[model samples]
Target: MLNAIVIGGGLAGSQAAIYLADNNVKVKLYEMRPNKTTGAHTSSDFAEFVCSNSLGAQSVTSASGLLKEEARLLGSKLIEEAYNNRVPSGNSLSIDRWGFSKKITQIIENHPNIEIIREEITQLPKTPTIVATGPLTSDSLCSEIKKLTGEDNFHFFDAVAPIVKKETINFEKAFYASRWDKGNADFINCPLNKDEYENFYNILTTAEKIPLKSFEAKYFEGCMPIEVIASRGFDTLRFGPMKPVGLFDKRTREEHHKNYQFYAVVQLRQDDKQADLYNLVGFQTNLKWGEQKKLINSIPALENAQIVRYGVMHANTFINSPKILNKTLQTKFNPNLFFAGQITGVEGYSESIATGLFAGINMLRHLRGEKLLELEAKCMLGALLEYITFANHKAFQPINSNWGIVEKPQEVEKLKKKSKEEKGALLSNIALEYIKEIRNGYFC
Candidate 1:
């Protein structure tokens, strides 16, 4: 007789279920794996980490660490179990994959208010539901989601360029300008001479690439990875993504006076409203992270770039959250329905859990006819949700929990000349204090 249903027992779904069950809300948790497996999953366990065994750094100075601390403050069941089932990983919260999965499975199956259902939910239920089906969501449910959100808002593949914190990008070597000076000076242009272009080109062509999974083998001609384009020929990238056509570097041109002209240029577009983050304009890549760092560093403008999210070209199923969901993770189309996890355009283990944990709390509130929590952007989890819900929909991409996403608290804004670690510690302190206030004030 449970009216509340949580679909797809992944990280987000599982966290949502646990939070709701702990609050005495009977939850029917559904898992589709072992009955209908995804391309990545190897087991039927709830909260199974499909990718990395390491969650992230456990130090509060790190972004993932701040999220975990806030989750701990909010009594997150998954975060507690992650630590309890953790293995030796130094400062990183790494765990024994099998043991962690089994522990989580045991907990979910034994929870008194939870009903473990071994089935696939193809249809979105009319009753209150949280669709945390994740990136590898099933075809049928994908279809249902597509119908609910429309085809334009749903994406089956992720072709994303690396995003860098604007503060880290060496502006001395880069200048903001629009192509042909036709629009606002919106693009950060990194002008590369012949030597720099060739050097970047050589490294990119030889970089290690992650072979697409069997299910993700299909490559669209127009949207091939940057590495693939480089492999075609030496001049391919110069004419393509790295093209310098119409980009008149007015700043450097004024300094050099017609002596400086770019052989090729790399462009970065403003990714956030704050303009604090910018993404490589056409740098959608599948290169290994090590190689990505090497190639990005070769560019003069990106010599010391701090990549917030790396370029990822993978078979992923995520909705355009800014277009479809509120900051509460509830869909704009249906108030009774909610979404969390990778499907909500949030990447990483802790981030998925944060969304699910919040959705669960908000779902319970929704059932009780109370105002849902739209956590303030000062908190790590709140900032992530705010980004997904309010980011530009035209180029919305999945993001992990990164310091670049968190807003500076007004109190922190007053203080200046602090080291990066010190600034991060200050932000973490603000987030923890904010979450603690919510935990104390909220009834559920």
Candidate 2:
């Protein structure tokens, strides 16, 4: 049997270890969790979701959905585990955060071929290794990584939204509905009248925020602090996350809503399997804890909202993948060393799991002395790998899976003839076909 080392028990590392162990590899997985803390995490479980529980949409036409589908075709362990612990979120893949991590922790701990190490690995290993330490990497291991790459990792700040007790929300001001009636009423919508929106905006923008001097880093655009987003403009929130389009608050009749339905709306997504907790959608903030509680209380439907967890901001570090990694996710200097997840400059939960899945696959091939497999350029996983490993290293920022990164059909006339959804369907089919073909060859 072959031996492999997996560092970090977060999403990526856990995925890599599970894939390897299932394939008959003797693996040692290292996690520095309860013993060492990353300020963002609140649990000791593997694959813990520290930020939002949602993993984007599940439709194959969507970018993240397609990436997840591709990983599923490739037999991604964490992806399956995610679905097993999923919650109701319309078309999106939201999970019971606690259940998802707990299941993965149990599986990893009990695996026969995998040995769990409850310690931190401060330096890179010379053996077959996959470093999936993720974004919140410890300072000591980061220094060791820097020594190998000779480049400082780019740092960004990620903000998490606050979770509120569901029963505390005032039903009179809030209603259950999904946007455009796309599915059952999976989202808790808090509609705001013009005056109420104005008041909420004023309070949100003026709320005291924690000092940024501690991190001294710029916020990732995808997870910007709500207050920072508010600073952009008064109407930015309305146009962005708080947009009131495609929603009908049944309580307001057409006669009463003759002019407009609502000025803005806030959405809270279900967080746990029991449906007792919901996180403020797109309300990631760095406000002081007291200010966060006050802000939540100010929402019309949340006048007495009980906060289960306050929003927080944390430092994230990622390597410059274009400079240091090959398309196979292997380090340029060491074939035995590969980096996965956010550390490889790919963003989002599905993207992280996809990278780790492929890294584990290539590691198996390396052990067999076979050429590392490069996913087809037309596929979702392939496009992400191509973008990160070949993009301009100096200006590279973390990226999520999007159609723009994937290879597009060359026939201009065909594309012009199709609607947006039609185009997405065509692209998805192409990507899936490629991934399915790999399935037979790699796993059979």
User: By TM-score, who's the top model here?
Assistant: 2
* Residue 3, candidate 1: C-alpha displacement in angstroms: 3.0
lDDT of 2 by residue, 1-444 (tens): 899999999998999999999989999999998899999999899999989998998999998899999999898989998999999999999999999999999999999999999998998899999999999999999999999999888888999999999999999889988887797889999988889888888888888888875656867788888898899999999988899988777666565755455778899999999999999999998999998988778789999999989999888999989989999999999999999999898988999999999999999898878899887679999999999998565688989999888888775236887786788888999899988888888678
Query: Would you list the C-alpha lDDT of every candidate in the order shown?
Result: 0.81, 0.90
Distance from true location, Cα of 300 in model 2, Å: 0.4
Candidate 2: which pairs clash? none
* Global Cα RMSD, each model: 12.6, 1.4
* Pairs with backbone N, CA or C atoms under 3 Å apart (clashes), candidate 1: none
TM-score for each of the candidates = 0.67, 0.97
Model 2: weakest 10-residue lDDT segment is 252-261
Candidate with top lDDT is 2
Give the TM-score comparing model 1 with the true structure, all chains together: 0.67
Query: What local lDDT score does residue 309 receive in model 1, on the 0 to 100 scale?
Result: 75
